[model samples]
Target: MKKQPIHKIHIFGSVGSGKTTMAKNLSKVTGIPCYEIDNAVWIRNPSVDIRRTDQEIERNLQSIVQTNSWIIEGVHTKDWVNQSWQHADIIVFLNTSYFTRTLRIIKRFIKQKLGFEKANYQPTFRLFLNMFKWNKQFEKVDKVRFLQMTEMYEEKLIIINNRQDLNNWINNL
Candidate 1:
């Protein structure tokens, strides 16, 4: 079967769910520019991290969506990201197991701490601990919220629960 052309893509999931990795892969396959919402949300400072103003974030997001085609990935599912969801031709939601996500988080932190991986923020012990808390919060609270929000875009939403499911979806694409 012929693969459908994707113009705009949005990937959302909990930390360590591989949203960025999937977005990068999709960008490579589709030749669409990929934008990380974290970049828009946080202003990278070498000494300390500062957050962008709401207006700034909105403007940044607007600019990305205005492009001809792009992939946007982030764990954010709040009102700030509603526009991206509305503009997306497809929304990929990674729902891997909590165990898998936890392991990934540990591995990712190690990679970032060792400077083997590029991260939007400095990987510190606080951030490392927060990942676990965020993962739990995501499973307990955000999962239901994300499901409810994505239901309106059911036709465009694709949920992948495991590596095999992800590979199948990408291969079939």
Candidate 2:
């Protein structure tokens, strides 16, 4: 069966789970604008991230959601982002394995450090180390929260466990 066209898409996952990649690809294929939550959360600083105020972040996100069509991607699943999920026609959760996410995080750090990849934050060793910690924290806390929250939007939620699942979903789209 043909898939319905998606207008508002929200992609959420743990760090290094390829949310940004998938959002970009969906934007390209669907002709929808993509909004990265990092842009709303952090000020552009070459050396370190200076986070925007909570009000500022919410304002930015609200602006994006006010648009007719958009794809929002981020690892953030906090209360502040509940509106985005509520507005979404589809919500994607990239539930990639811990091993895969760890490797991707390492590879991404190297690429960003070498200037081969564009990143939201500086490719500092400190940031790289923190990714591992963040990953673990997400697994222990955020994962359960995501699962629970998704239950409320089960009809719109799509969980991609691996690259094959992601590819198939995109292909169907």
Task: Give Cα distance to truth, residue 73, candidate 2, Å.
Answer: 0.5
Q: Tell me the tens digit of each residue's lDDT in model 1 across 24-48.
A: 9888877999999999899898877
Q: How close is candidate 2 to the true structure, as a TM-score?
A: 0.94
TM of each candidate vs. truth: 0.94, 0.94
Q: Report the lDDT tens digits of candidate 2 across residue range 41-144.
A: 98897766798888899899999998889999988866778889988999999998899999999999989888899876768888889999999999999999
* Runs in model 1 lying further than 4 Å from the true structure: 1-4
lDDT of 1 at 92: 91
Model 1 clashing residue pairs (backbone)? none
Among the numbered candidates, top lDDT falls to 1
As for candidate 2, its clashing pairs are none
Q: How well does candidate 1 score on lDDT at residue 143? A: 88
Model 1 poorest ten-residue lDDT run: 74-83
